[model samples]
Target: MEIKFNDVNYKTKLTDINITLNNSKINGVYNYNSFLKVLLNPKLIEKGNITIDGKVYNKYDPKVIAVIDKDMPFYTSKVIDEILFYSKIRGYKNNNIKEDINNLLEKFNLDSNILKRIGHSLSETEKYYIKLIANLIYKPKIIIFKDIMSGMDYKNKKIIKKLMEELKEQGVLIILTSSNSNILYELTDEVVIFNKGKVLINGSTNDIYSNIEILLNNNIDVPYFSLLTYKANNEKGAHLFYRKDVRDVIKDVYKSVS
Candidate 1:
């Protein structure tokens, strides 16, 4: 999605702006207090008027919460509060929002009992809540994860890789961006190199690795087995790219020696 601003004016206390999403006008009004509130505390509430298929929405409607998945409960609660505060203005009526809340909590294996006691770190719980909401709402076509495996140990990383492959098979666009080129070489079909915000190279993992200088410059280390092959190939005056090529070279060397 592309965003553009038009006829924008900013003052110390007042700002008028227009925001376009996917080449359509999504926000046109300016409220300094609301803008400041959002800027100061982004997680306090969900901002911006959302329009799906050209229909403008109040953004606190159940359908809106359903679509956004109430991922940030605090923000959702704020939205609920705002709705209640302006209930007379919007002609809103109270309903059983608890059912929806319960359904959301159930996805994360959370219950009201646990929520009340809440000895766990708020950040961790927030992450779980966000993930649950994201999964519940807007099953996105493309999901990009960057360096998620970096801090994880082997066992946890393996689980993540397996989950990624499963998501890939389910037709989700899974893009894993990592500095660990060896891991990417083992797991991904393609590799893309970025330098100073520009795409330096993009090709099959094997193809990109053929240029060792580019990989080294980008801090992408070659795999250990590949290093072995490099040494063997240098002794025989041969250059090979993929592991299969290296195996064939080794087999040829064995045949000649035997």
Candidate 2:
């Protein structure tokens, strides 16, 4: 599945955007909310086109799913009812949906009893989890998560990371948008850096972050560990490698010092 944004211009907020996303890996789009709006709703693009598999894009595209920050309101009172409703509408082929829902609950660390509770009464985090379950039932080819990770705790993020890896193995295209550079570095295989509504650079996450000078020149935030590694190499004359985990960086620094 490929979504191509061809010369997309949106009323001065976005300009001449041309990017093609074809791979089924976890892609991190950095700091481009306006471009996201255009991708999700091509009607907002005043000057260009958004195509899915070389065809015109539409909201009803079956392969595309999004779990946004402002989650959809539950149509039914009970959480179970809401999930059932979504499964029914999305044409979920599983014969035993209740069993499937329970399995998802187990993976997400939610108790079975929570399904019987009122949907509106669930906490914000719980609501987000439910929404994700609803979308994952049908196994979309492309999934977009926008501005949703800043509030998640470490445990939640770990669960999500594992789930995303599983989805990637199943050939699901995942696009994650977050303000946290560290989160992106931890989760994304590819990174597309955007500045002031334009494509600044897009490439493999490791390569993009390794070029610290370009990011610093553009005033883009680099991952904390990457910056630390760069500073240690440049200022202290220490040879240290870039690492995602701070503990790994600490161990490497210690080895260099000793």
Candidate 3:
């Protein structure tokens, strides 16, 4: 499905933004409130004449998409039951779901016992993985993940990163949003960076992440590596992080010295 935003300006949310997005590539939008405003009202672009797969779509059709946020709570006694509820809501029948539940647990590296425990008692990763697994039951054509890495440590980020890769491989258009620049750099194919009420730039993940000055000027949290590379360039005229490789950074350090 392709979503086109044509010459759109919505109150204080958007300003003459025009972009076409479709397919399985991971796209990102950075900036907390801007991300929410866009995600919450995707149909708002309809006023500017939106089309899905080349046809006009005027109504709100969020069913074709699933927006996963960590703060969204599942109201169920047990974890497995909650998963079932969401799956059914998405049009998947029960029909012997035990094996499916088990598979999901294993896929997310979650313990089987969590399935029988309270839905709300699990850790952040557990909740996110469970919700994602549930969303997959009906196989949404598009999935939007927001703020899933807010409080995650580096190790947890890697784990979630692997899960994101799996999702990307599913042939679904994926849209992600995070305040953490590292998460966007690690998972996104392309990104749209917003400052205040307008888009600052829309570029490849590496390009946007490598633009340390612009990102810092907008007060966006930049990846540590990008910052290190920018500082290195200022100190030694060696643009190391632009290559976005740790080995390149080391090699640049050597060249700078000798």
Candidate 4:
């Protein structure tokens, strides 16, 4: 499952853009409003071709591409009602919805009370996980999580990363949208960083992070771990690459100094 944008244009906002994203991979699109509206809402996609698996589409399948935008509306008052309704619509028509939903809730470490509460009653993290479960039950070929990691604590971010890893293992085409570079570096296989609504750079995480100058020029913040490592390497003549955990980075620093 690969999605490609071949010289796709939208509303004089985004110029001709070309992108190819493959299956079982997580990619980050670091952009804002105009770009997102055009990507997720196929009604606004125009002036060019958007293809899934190298074929032109008269209509993009909603089931094939799911975008879990943070601002997207939820009609149901109760969480269980909302999840069950959408799940069935997306092809989960089994009679054991309650049992299935409970399993999903447990999978995400969400409490059972989530089913009893209204959408507004849940915290941002709760909302994110529940929405994720709702979308996952649909078995979408491609899942887009919009700004899912922003404002999340490091510990919670780890849990989110694990869930994303599970999605990748399932051979799902995952796209995460965030202006936050820190999350993108750790969470995505590749990243397409946008500058003023155009592609600045789109490459593997290693390549993208290696060029700190480009990120700085675009006003994107480098991950704190990268910064510390860079400073240590520059000032103390220490060599360390940013890892998932700070303790590993510290060990590398110590080894370098010793």
Q: Estimate each model's TM-score.
A: 0.44, 0.89, 0.85, 0.84
Predicted model with the maximum lDDT: 2
What is candidate 3's lDDT per residue for 1-258, written digit by digit as tens?
Answer: 676666666667777776666665688878747445654566655246555677765565456778887888886778878878877665666666778777767776788888788976887777888887777666677778887877777776777677667877876777888777877887788888878767788878888877779878878888878888788888767756465567886787677767
Question: Total clashing residue pairs per candidate?
Answer: 0, 0, 0, 0
Distance from true position, residue 235, model 1, in Å?
A: 5.7
Question: Candidates 2 and 3: which is better by TM-score?
Answer: 2
| Residue 82 Cα positional deviation in candidate 3, in Å, after optimal superposition | 0.7
The candidate that wins on TM-score is 2
Tens-digit lDDT track of model 1 for 1-258: 232223223333223333332311111111123332322233333323333235543233332222112233432233223223333333444464445445555644555453443323345434444443333233343344534444455654565566566656665554554556566666666655544323455556666665565655666466655665566566766554446354665675566456
Using TM-score, rank the candidates from best to worst: 2, 3, 4, 1
As a TM-score, model 2 comes out at 0.89
What's the lDDT for all of these models? 0.44, 0.82, 0.74, 0.77
Q: After superposing candidate 3, which stretches have Cα over 4 Å from the reference?
A: 42-47, 94-97, 153-155, 239-247
Error of 2 at 196 (Å): 1.1
Each model's Cα RMSD? 12.2, 2.3, 2.7, 2.8
Which residue window of length 10 is worst by lDDT in model 3?
Answer: 38-47
Q: How much is 118 displaced in model 3, in angstroms?
A: 1.5
Report the lDDT of model 4 for residue 40. Answer: 60
Better of 1 and 3 by TM-score: 3
Q: Tell me the tens digit of each residue's lDDT in model 4 across 154-253.
A: 7778787887888888888888888777788888889887776577789888677766777777787787777777677777777677665777977887
The candidate, 1 or 2, that scores higher on lDDT is: 2
User: Per-residue lDDT for 122 in model 2?
Assistant: 95
Once model 1 is optimally superposed onto the true structure by TM-score, how far is the C-alpha of residue 10 displaced, in angstroms?
24
